[model samples]
Target: MGRNTRKRRTPLATKIVAGAAALAVGGGGLVWANFYASAHEDHGGHNRTRSAGAQVATIDCPDVGQKIRDVPDRARGEVDGELASMDSQITDAYQRLATTRRAQAGDARFVENSILGPLKERRKALIDRIQLEINRAGGKADDNLDELAGCQGRPADQQQDGDGQDGGGGQDDGQNGGGQDDGQNGDGQNQDDNGNGVAGPVADDFIDINDVQPNSRNSRNGLAADGDGGSTGTFSTDCGVNENNLFNSDNLIAAPGVDNGAHHTHDYVGNQDNDAFSSDEDLANADTSCQNQGDKSTYYWPVLRLQDGTQEFDANDQGGGAEGNIGKILKPAQAELKFVGSQQGDVVAMPKFLRIITGDAKSFTNGDANANTSWSCSGFEDRQVTDKYPLCPEGSQVLRTTNFQSCWDGQNIDSANHRDHMAFVQEDGSCPEGFQAVPQLQVRLAYDIPTPTVENGQVRNPYAVDSFPEQLHKPITDHNDFINVMDENLMNEVVDCINRGEDCQ
Candidate 1:
């Protein structure tokens, strides 16, 4: 069943401690090693080696555990320095291992000397350091040795902070039956965290091109609406790598509060510090990582994976493969922000923290409802067609494009059901009757996932984001969500651009 769980958070004080196996799996030493015994002679007729090994219960070393639990303010810096260095080393080794594995998939001991051996010695020294700390804290160093040794040889991805899960956003393990999240997500008026009512009913009875003009697939990328019902102008912004502003997952649709992020994982970009516990004040006060010096909004969505059920993240086991687009994750190339449905004048400003969901996150991966998904060659739209996974032309990158509904009932920033506040625009780029029109937000992302094999010129391995919840393991899970965090200044810039009917890029 699709049960919602509140997000759990680790406090600031304890976050400084390094996780276990923070620096293992270097070089050829990653060959799985099972704990064994060097001495069999027992004076008491009972095996000390085997008995000691079974006591390994803690995930981290004993001293490190204490530091992790109660890191004092005065000694926090020293502990942080050690953990930061260890994490850096682990991350670097994992990247190199990934790269080398790409080329040396068959070479078993190729990296044995350079990376693994040194990491082994380094771990020994770290254990010694931990022992010293334990003695200073008046704890038993001898009793922790066996458990500490067992913590060695772990791969780097296990070193990730927090839960050590995928992207630190937590993975959704195919919660609902049939391994699908197709429960109308917002069905039963349960989509959102707020008490608001469900937005308008889900527009069932699927329509095609002639049936509806602008839909999940088309009529986006415009400047303003003309009297003749055509669209003109274009506006866009590129948001690059946002390493700071983030949250792995949150259940709250709009409000940023602690312990309420969704059970599944997501990647957040733009405004730094936009986590589960963040408030509107936290967002407004935070700086942005975008190039658009003025805008400070957070854009997020579920992460995508390749058909082979692999994504280039050091989530579960790091250093598995290296380089070569081994399932590289994708992000928006540009955010196409436009206002539609208005024949004249500027569009009204959207409420801050307004929530939006675009494309059916639960749509089947192929040729249905225009698939509500698009795949194309970079800078090439001619190859974009529904149900067909066409090959990209030489010198072009493959891309996916998606559109969000643009009409609002104007009474709420959100609804109980996740969809009511937003309505799809018409094929003519106009809002539907009775629903007020807002900016038509569109996002097109580029990906470098595994390409299909051509045996006798026939393409294979064609896939799409499969379904919701368990997105990392499926394709055709092409759904995305967003929250409006732009302050008044940037909001007005959007308003002015739409009002002048000039497409500003």
Candidate 2:
């Protein structure tokens, strides 16, 4: 979310900080031993050990966004700014790791002493500041926030095998795909990074859609299975697939007022005026791309790009090639936004300015607890994968689907973590005790991307979603954001149409 000039909160000052893991030497030996002992013990109590000489791939930090859930309204803006800064710190550190290969090889403690150590200290300072803000606002901060400041160096092939839990670069039962490869390109120019010597979207990241087993998912909404009862109706909105080329790297929800907070570009639809500085009133007064003038909501997600060495506009910019997100941006061929009723009963009208984020953008490191991925081919929509990128056969197109949380807390339009205010349906397909079901927003994005080639375990001309440099462009990190700005009359009309079991646009 970009903004014009204003005396705003401090922004992240770009500075290169080393990030990677290498053999501990000199002053880093004790720290490495401690890290090794703790990393094996602390990740959700799942003890998995890596070999002593296993290559440390990337920095794995505990996501503070999920913590500090009790921030007060008065302190939220400041805390959010600090959280955004933390992300930038990691990005800069990763840049150093990705670019300085010779330094890491020559000095055994280069990564630990120069990269991981400083990162921990900086994160600790930010965490302390968050605690102070919460306490000042009469909110109870999490007692163990200090413990989250430290991060571990994850191995390249590490997988979270035991317990099928999220957290730490574990492949949770196919939730985050298979083991990560060395992210080499078919051309074999750069061996460690992606084909472009940037971050990732390794050769193993993609799988043919035909190879995935069919019928792995059961119908959740009842309308798909022709079942009786439930609202069983739908309302579609005709927002173009960002044909106007509105793009940015700001996250208005998580990092409002911070530029390039997303560290990668996003494609926007519906609202024409959206950025980190967009207030509710600003959005209400802005123009919209929706055919219906009454609906001025905002919808956005990471943009997909083809890794064919094409330099887009942001090639030399902060959130583009400079940060390892290099390639030609791919426009979606189709973007469908639909509202559906719940399986249990009819849904009520959503309040205006309601915000919802459907997936986790940092799922690569933070785990799959918030991952909401749905990748498949146009013809093979029945077979969806959460982690692996789908390689559609000839004549078929790639598709990405997102189902927003339907159950609202009925109190707040937003939450501190941007997630607690909404909830997904339970196993029995009903809303929770104190929640009410609302129209679920299902977004389907289709792309007419050319199938990539793989030879000798290296991909060529691959397509991947833009992501945080440390996220490695993994598919599980895909996410979407929405803010409902529909007029009251239109909102009521949508609810009415759903209750009446009719489809309307």
Candidate 3:
């Protein structure tokens, strides 16, 4: 891989100082904070502040999807379209902020007055349209949405996800470790390899694996307790590591029919016809990348890129460099997709087209309440770090592990926020009430990337996961998307293998 040769922009003013803030832990043990102010929120006027001698890092907007509990079936299409438009507005505003660093340094309120102000107005208009769509379909519009239209400017190096402590057990029994690297020099202004000065993946976002304490989860290994009927079998599916180079920025589940909805490219495997405009019938008939033709399920996640200067095919595209995600995309050395049974009881077959999204793509601004990223090194799999990218030693491959939700609500194939239909297993390895255990899909991707360097607070040739422009390419924002399209017989076979304590491929 070529070394990152892009000219890094140095902030003209004093470097940003870290901010002292607290995160409010939300559901699923995730952490969050109210970044928007209340008054004039209806008109998109929220309190935005920059710390003394600090720079505005990225835009922080309320997640409109999370706030909208329900959209009538007839209004779903229009509501989704408006949400996609809101994302585009944020991307446009961020692009302007990134390209106007010099102007921002010259004017104290340039970011607020020029970029954020107009961005909020646009968001408010879109949000109003969303309200109208829901009400027109005879569905109740959320009252809190008026306050969600406004976004604020967050200072650089503000802590969002991990606690200040160095090492600790994770929030679940499955994985007992999650923490972000807390190393910030705060000495120099630096731009990522993409040349986006304010958007991040700064030097502090990486940590050496040797520095992390061992915090792996205590797995039940699909074993059942006395009298407990647990499914103990395993099934493995062989899907190529996106060798076909299936790449796109569309999020079919979140913003269907909207091009470039993701604002970042994804590496796809499994179903061949997965994209923004793909319908259920299209996916069912699509060619399969999996070794088993019956397993046409679609699996995808954000592509990991080496910050080297080499421009890939999407270098000039909207979801690529144009949105601040630029680099040479790296193909995973190994992509392992496995299905394991529940520890508490037998697992049922996943409904076809059941969509599940793990982790929060906007964790940098929304906090880590829903963040489930587990990054480690090959030899250091037991030491997983959620918020920080690991600097694996020579000969050790970098690893990204994703453990999907194993419990399903059994009714709907999808939910409004794309999350209410599924739930993670409880600490005791049991499913929640009204949820049944399903074969949990675990994805592990290994990459052979050279360790990046942090010199005088400037990161050189770092490897970062693709992210939304305003998310700053934070590792905590890493996420995965899945659509179960397995044929009925194959899914039943998977359930049978798990329930019968047998291993099958």
Candidate 4:
């Protein structure tokens, strides 16, 4: 202070500012050194940065043009490849189906040799193979095309940018990518929104069987009757004949003089007084003789004939009594015969004869050449005709064999009967063996049961004679039109996906 030499006093404010500026410069220099060190890091850190650098670098590539100009061409190429593969599979399947159809037809030679036994197995294998191929191709083509169409350009770091917006040494940002945006102008590609390739004018070459409805009437089994009251029960001739008094009793073989086999003695009294009594006496004596022989008082029998013209006895008929002799009872000339019986424990014994024919009397021969060529009979008759006399009642007319012909009424003869009988007259005039007049019940079963055929190792309707209009309309050149429609629909959907730049999977 005494030297006054402390020339000028420095200001406190200026001194403080100078110190702050110095500190700021030092801190800035440290930060710059740290950044430089990181940029030039060693291999260990270098690798990590390199990974990120790759992504960033790729983003610089020009954004894939919004035109997506390559999609249609690529998709079409893929579609063509898939179509070729599908064609091969389809061809194989068609061949198999054809082979199966041929086998099922069973030419006369194949039937004789049983050569078609393996046809079904072959068909199945081929179908499975073709189906697998179709599925594989369908999935691959669908997914691949979709993936290609949806492919987006990499980010800025991954792709080189053609523009020079950033500094010459600018770092890349990994955000830019290419793909269809949500905007309406989307990728300049046309695609069916519903994902059905059928949106455009349908190709004439393409076939879809699904458009046609199947024919329900193709079933091989015949139609069933509409009413519950229709035929029921099996037709059979198992009953045995009666053996007691033949003339008047219900026995198959009644004696000549006793009324033992008599069943309707009371019914005959008013019509013929003396005749009734005489018949009753004859039946009684026959009954006595049968008992002596250890035979039942009454027995029954059925008449069975074979195609070979052989006949067998089933059950015996009950004999008539006092009212009129059983032998004297009349039956309609043109009636079908039905034998009613009672079950003796488990065995049914023949009882009475019922006639089915109505209207006028009809004559039928037992195929006996020596028998009467013609005979008169009532419209309906129930009495048995002796082997020697082929005739109906005095007032009836005769029906020649020519009058009977085959006709079906679509009604089952019987509902309860499961047994079936097929009667056919051979051109040789010989009848089949073991054939008997079928009861109403058995006829229905034969007409209704479905006939089976082997197809692709499985039993199917081989004898199916019915077809629908749609089936007939199908082109013989291609079977795709005949496959289930749903499968075709799915294939169309996949195709649509390929048309549009969308992910099919």
Highest TM-score scorer:
2
lDDT of 4 by residue, 49-99 (tens): 322211110101111111112223223233323322322232233223222
Across 456-504, the per-residue lDDT of candidate 1 in tens digits comes to 2122343333222111112233456666777677777776676666677
Residue 49 local lDDT, model 2: 39
List model 2 lDDT by residue over 1-505, tens digit each.
2222222243222222221121111111011111111112234535343222223556789999888797999999999999999999888776555544445544557678778889999999999999999999999999799999987766555663331322233222222222232123211123333335554566667788888778664423323212466787889999898876777778889998888889988888998788888899989998888999998999999989887766566655566666667677888899999999877778899999999998899887887778886889998988878778888999998999888889999998999999999998887678888999999999999999999986665577888898887787888899999999999999999998888889999
Q: Report lDDT per candidate.
A: 0.40, 0.73, 0.72, 0.19
Predicted structure 1: lDDT: 0.40
Off by over 4 Å in 3: 1-54, 161-198, 216-228
lDDT of 3 by residue, 433-463 (tens): 9999999988889999999986654566778
What TM-score fits each model?
A: 0.49, 0.85, 0.82, 0.12
- The order by descending TM-score is 2, 3, 1, 4
The TM-score that candidate 1 achieves is: 0.49
**Per-residue error (Å), model 1, residue 91:** 29
Model 2, position 106: C-alpha lDDT score: 49
**Model 2: residues >4 Å from true position, as ranges?**
1-54, 161-194, 217-226
